[model samples]
Target: MPQTENQTQVTDRPQATKTAILVIGGAEDKVHGKEILQTFWQCAGGTDAIIGIIPSASREPALIGERYYRIFADMGAKEIKVLDVRDRDGGRDSAYLHYVENCTGIFMTGGDQLRLCGLLADTPLMNLVVERVRAQEIALAGTSAGAAVMGHQMIAGGSSGECPNRALVDLAMGLGIIPEVLVDQHFHNRNRLARLLSAISAHSDLLGVGIDEDTCAMFDSDRNLQVLGRGTVTIVDARDISYTNQNQVHGADPISIHNLKLHVLRYGDRYNLEGHQVIASS
Candidate 1:
C-alpha cells in the first residue's frame, strides 16, 4: 500500500521496509559527477530501472540539452525522459506525465529549487511523485536544489555563506522524502557550516546535514545514512544543549555549545538517523 503523507511520515517509517533516497551535491556529469550517478544506478538495480530526469529546476531548460540525457542512456537506463516542470503548467505535459508514471528512479537535476517547487507544488505531477515514493517502488535522487527539497524543511538562502536566523531564511515544506534532517549542499566548498549550524540551533529538534560538493549521501529504507564521493558529509547534532545571549555576543562572540557531536563521514560510512549515531567506519 502507498503510504499517505499523513499516515507514515518519512522519519517514522519502519526502517526495515523503507526505500532509498539519494541526495547529491552539485557538479553532476560524466566528467566529474559520473561516480555519483553510477552509484545511484547501482543502488537502483542497474540498467533495468526506469529513470526520469526532472530538468524543470534549470534556469534555462536548454542548458540541460541532449548531452545530459545521452549520458543516462549510455549508462544503460531502460528509458530516459526529461520533465520540464519549470513551465507555468508545472510539467503537466503528456510526455512528462507518462515518464513519471513509468519511472522506477527519478533524478532531479541541480538547479533552482524555488523554480522547481513553484512549478510543481500542488500539481498533479508532484502528487504522482509523492505517490511513487510512498509506494517504495521508486527511488528519489536530487542534486543541489533537487537535494534541498527532500526534507520537510528546505534551505532557500539569499547569499552563498550567510547564516540565517529563524525568520531570515526562506523555508518551505519539501517533498517529504526525508524528514527531521535539514540538508545543505556544497558544504565545505561553499563554507556553509555556519548557515547549517544556525539552522539547527534555531530548530534544536531538527538534524543538520551538510554534504560537500561532488559527494553523495544515501539514506536507506531504515533511515540509515551512508556517505559517498570524494568529499565529506558533516553531521551537526544540537539535540540537547544550553545557550545564553547568542544575540548579544560581540566581535567574534565566544558562544559555548555543549552536547553537540560533530561527525565527518566519508565514502562507505553509515549512520543510524534515529539514534543520531554512526554505525560504520569510513
Candidate 2:
C-alpha cells in the first residue's frame, strides 16, 4: 500500500480542466488488492463512472473487452460497454461513436501495438478520444501495449536481456497522447532496460519511460507523473547527452552514448515531466 497523500484526489479538478492519464504496465493485479485498477476506477468518477473498454489490440477482442467490462461493473460503475472495434470501419459505427461520446472514462486493453494503431489510429473514434482527453473532459487509462501507444515515438518491438545496442529496439509512430515520452511496458520483469536505452539513443529528445509489471505512471494535467502499485517506473532522460553513435552504427552493434540521466521511482514518488525533476516519495 504505497499510497501518496494526494493520490486519491486524482479526479478532483477545476471546472473545464483536464483529467489524469493512467499508463499501466502489463499484468496489473486483477484480484486481491488491485490498487492500480482501483485508482483508475476512482479517477473515472467512481460510482458515477460511465466506462468504455476498447479491446481492439487483443486478438480475442470480445473476450478481452468483456473481461474489462466485468472489472468495471464489479466496481459499481454506472454503465459499462465494450467497444470491440476490429477494423477502421468499426471505428465509425454510430453505436461505438455514441459510447465514445457519452463515456466518462475510456480504457484500452493490452495486446499488439501495431494492431491497435492499424485499427484505430487517425480514425474518427480515436480522433474524438484524443479531443476529449486533451480538452480535460475524460479520464483515460491504457495498459501494456495500450501504454506503448501513448507517445509519439513508439517502441514497437525489440529484444531483451542484452546489453544496450543500436538495433536492440524497434520504433514506430504512436497515438501521441503524451507526445514527449517514449513508453516501454513490462520493463524490469522483461529485462528491458537495455531495450529502452537503445530507444532513447535514437530519439534523445523524448523522455524514455519504462513501466514495470503491476505498476502505473499516472500523469496529471500539468505533466506531473506519480507512481502507484507494486513496482517502479524508470525514466531515461537523454536531453543533455553529449554524444552517441546511433547514426553511425549499423545492426545490433553496441552504441556509444554519454550523459544519459535516469530515475527509478516507486509508489508515492512523483516526477515532473515538464521540468524533468524528481519529487521523491516522503
Candidate 3:
C-alpha cells in the first residue's frame, strides 16, 4: 500500500519555477518504441538533448535508472544521466547536483511520489534544479509518481470511488511547477473522479486534472495544456464552483457542490490552463 503522507511537514511557500509540466500517467509505452518518450526527446532538443533520469522515488533504483538509460539511448538521446539519490545526503551531493544541473531535461521516474518529494524537496540540488527551471533553461518531465508532484497542491493519498466526500482524499504541498493545479495520474483506470473532486472542493481555486494511463498532459509556461497518449484526460474546473460542503461536513458524509465543471479530452486536444477553457487546436 502507498503511504498517505510522510513525516515531512507540508508548507505553504510557493516556488517560482516555470516550465512545461510534461506529466505522463503510469505505464507509458516504452518497450516497443518511443511513442511517449519521443515527445519528451523532441522537447529536449531531440538528438542533441542531454537527458537525466531521476529514479530516487523508485524502490529498485538501479533497475529503474537503467530502464530509461536503455530506452533513451535507443532513441538517440545525446547523453543519458541518472541521479539515484538513495538518501538526503546523496541529494545534497555536489556530484549528483552537477549531473542534474547540466542536463537539458530532467525526468522523475515512477514509484512513490512522496519518496521523490522527500528526497529532493528544499535540498541544494533541488534549489539548483528549481533555479534552472525558473530561468526557463531546461525542460522537465515525469510519469506516474513523478507526475503527481508537479502541481502546487497535490493529492497525496485517497480512495477511488463514484461518490464524492471530504474524507475520500488527502492533500499535500507539491513542487509547484504547475501552479494552481492538483494533478492525479492513473485516473480513468482507477476511477478517481470522486477523490479528485473531493480534492478540488478542499481548495476550489485550484484546477484539477486527471490523466489516464499511457497518457501525457503537457503544459507550457503560459499554462496551455495539450493531451497525448492512448487514453482520455479529464479536467475538473472548480473555479466557478458556487457551492461546496467541504467545510460544513465531516467524515464520509456525502459532498455536494454546484456548478462544478468537467471536461474529457483525447490526444491532440488542447485547453487553457488558466481558465479551464478548451482551445481550438487541430
lDDT tens digits, residues 8-36, model 2?
A: 54443212123889999999988766778
Worst 10 residues of 1 by lDDT: 9-18
Better candidate by TM-score, 2 or 3: 2
Number of clashing pairs per prediction, in order:
2, 1, 0
lDDT of each: 0.72, 0.88, 0.80
Model 3 ranges with Cα > 4 A deviation: 1-19
Question: Residue 254 in candidate 2 has what lDDT?
Answer: 86
User: What is the overall TM-score of model 3 with all chains considered together?
Assistant: 0.90
Using lDDT, rank the candidates from best to worst: 2, 3, 1
Candidate 1 similarity to native, TM-score: 0.83
Per-candidate TM equals 0.83, 0.93, 0.90
| lDDT for model 2 | 0.88
Model 2 regions more than 4 Å off:
1-18
In candidate 1, the residue pairs with backbone N, CA or C atoms under 3 Å apart (3 or more residues apart, or in different chains) clash, namely 15-222, 18-221
Candidate 3 local lDDT, 1-282, one digit each (tens): 111121022132111223455888888888654456777877777788888888988999899999999888888989998888889898789887888777888888999888888888888887787777767787788999899988888788889765889889888878887777789999989988899888888888888889998888887777678776677789888888888988988878888989988889876677886566795433
Poorest lDDT segment (10 consecutive residues) of candidate 3: 1-10
